[model samples]
Target: MNPSIKKLSDIAQKTSKTIIGLMSGTSLDGLDIALCEISGIGPSTKVELKNFASVPYDSAFKNRLKAITSVPNVSLQEVTLMHTYLGNYHGELILKCLRKWAVAPSEIDCIASHGQTIFHAPKQQHNQPQMPNATLQIGDGDHIAHKTSILTISDFRQKHTAAGGEGAPMAGFIDEMLFTHDTEDRIVLNIGGIANFTYLPAKSKDRPSITTDTGPGNTLIDAAVRQLFSKEFDQDGKIAKHGSVNADALAAFKSDPYFRKPLPKTTGPEFFNLHWVENKLSKAGITNVSNDDFVATLTRLTAETIAESIKSILDDKSHPPLYVSGGGFHNPVLMDWLRKLLPDITISSFENLGFNPDAKEAVVFAVLANEMLAGEGFKMESAQTENISFGKISFPN
Candidate 1:
């Protein structure tokens, strides 16, 4: 057996485990490094977001990722170089976070990494006949383990894809594990670069719960901001606040076939990038709109799509309280829109559930690593659903 597997086995026998969970979302912002202290597993799990930090990627690195995102045809050499480089990059960031927190790598039980997503192509995304749903995330796990000298679990999405999921929102597992209730229906909405949610019914089961990508979240907004304003993102949604939303443009944006698709669907920047926005704008014949108005419309587009998704899933009388997380909650304009659109239900942040909204995604990986250590696997009702023991183990020399 692998030495890392032996270590994981030993760690599970202990009373508690400390782990580091790292995530780099599609936004290309940076790596979210979360040092978590967790105990137990499944519904009995207890998690503490011990230390959290987001190490921003420099201009050069960000540019490279953006190039790969915008340009379809990338050289094999670039992909290979980024895969190795990002692993070491992530490992170094881990060390920096540890030193800053006054912790030791040897003290950490394991590291669960949601590696950088290079390309995400669900069968639906491609609409290609006879092609399997596939996704790719590159950042060598062996490199992470070798550099950090800790047992590492990485490339979690592959198991989901292999098990017949789109491999986009693996957050459902952690959301259900952490947020499920016995009496009240709850929806855990994550507004990252792409919006996704996990709807936990009042009753629980071993089967896959309701989970799907709502639509574009911050990806389109961020792209528009970068192209028009030369800013990384609309800070506090100030740009959006400054301008009025073009209702006609917003209506046109919402007419995409993907939005009308049934639940359990997924999408990415590859589908909702600047080109999508530009096409909608051109179709609506709105060329002279100010950058602020464009941002405002994009913000409204997100809110409308999210509200429409909620309406599609639940009856008008069935109002479930929503627990929001991810980068989108910080956007005042988006939050304001949701509050207005979802007045029937209580809308709050994940902080009320004892988890930092920003650290939620990172914490999920930590919990997943804990599950891997415990030798636990899950089963869902549908064989086509994602149900498995996720994460690939890597050893340190």
Candidate 2:
């Protein structure tokens, strides 16, 4: 038998495997590395975060991604270079993290990397005929496996799109496994660069849980901050707290057809970026809005859209508590909007459930990798995500 295959066979038999999961979100902020020990398979799975870290990219690296991702067109060479560069960068980042965590590469069983999402244009967003629902995440799996010298699973979304999904809100498959409640219908709402949620019905048999991207989570706010104040993000949303939301601009922005689309929809900064915001402002005929006001309005827009999306899917008219995760929960202004808008709904951080919100997404990828290894043709299905085993594996040998 091949040495690599033998190693994999041995690793699979272990009771608990130490897996490293990496996530570089659309925010272009940094890479999230999560080391998780996951056991069991499917709904019987158990996951525990042993260590987690987010290594921020320096301005030069982030600028490179922005030039490649945020723009409509770019040099193909740079895009090609970025694909390889990001993979090697992330692999080295994982090695650095392993050193800091005082663990050897041999100690880890596998690596699950959610490569940087540069473009997420579903056919609905592009509106181009003959284009299937599409999305792109860079950072090659082969490079990661070679650099890390560990078995790696990457590019999990391709299978999702191929399986008739919008290739997003991939959370439901894992969220239901990790955080389902038997008596309480839980909404595991994640607000990363894009806001999405997993609706886990209390009784899994009666109504299957669904996951969907609500709309702009932190993407627009981050873009506006980068444009107005030359910052990657509005720290604690301080700028927005100082200003009032422009009702006219908010109304105009809400008029988008994307908001009217049905559930199981997906979107990204491509449709909800600074350019989109500026266009909305122009249509609203509001030219003199201050930076703070613009930021406030964007904040309001995210909260309103998220609230509305959640409300739209309540089959039992049951307003369940939201267990929130991701970067948006850190912004007090955004949190405040949710509180003020949905006064009766209980809003709490994922930390309340003993999971770091920042590390949740990374942990998810790790869980997915675990599923790939242990699934055993297990039936994994949700309303949005099809019953499919994702992630293309790369061997380091």
lDDT tens readout by residue for model 1, 1-397: 9765677678878778999999899999999998888888777888888889988999789999777663468988998998999999999999988999999899998899989998899898888969878889999999999999998999988887777777877788888887888777899999999999998887543434688899999999998999999999999999999999988888889888888899978988888988888898898787888889999999999998998898788886889899999999999999999989988979999899888888889998888888877746666443464548889988887
Error at 246, model 1, angstroms: 0.8
Give the RMSD in angstroms, all C-alphas superposed, for model 1. Answer: 2.0
Q: Tell me the TM-score of each prediction against the true structure.
A: 0.95, 0.96
In terms of TM-score, how similar is model 1 to the real structure? 0.95
Tens digit of per-residue lDDT, candidate 2, span 275-315: 78878878878898889998999999999999899888875
lDDT of 2 at 42: 77
Candidate 2 off by > 4 Å: 315-317, 376-386
Q: Per-prediction RMSD in angstroms?
A: 2.0, 2.1
Error of 1 at 346 (Å): 1.3
How far out, in Å, is residue 25 in model 1? 0.6
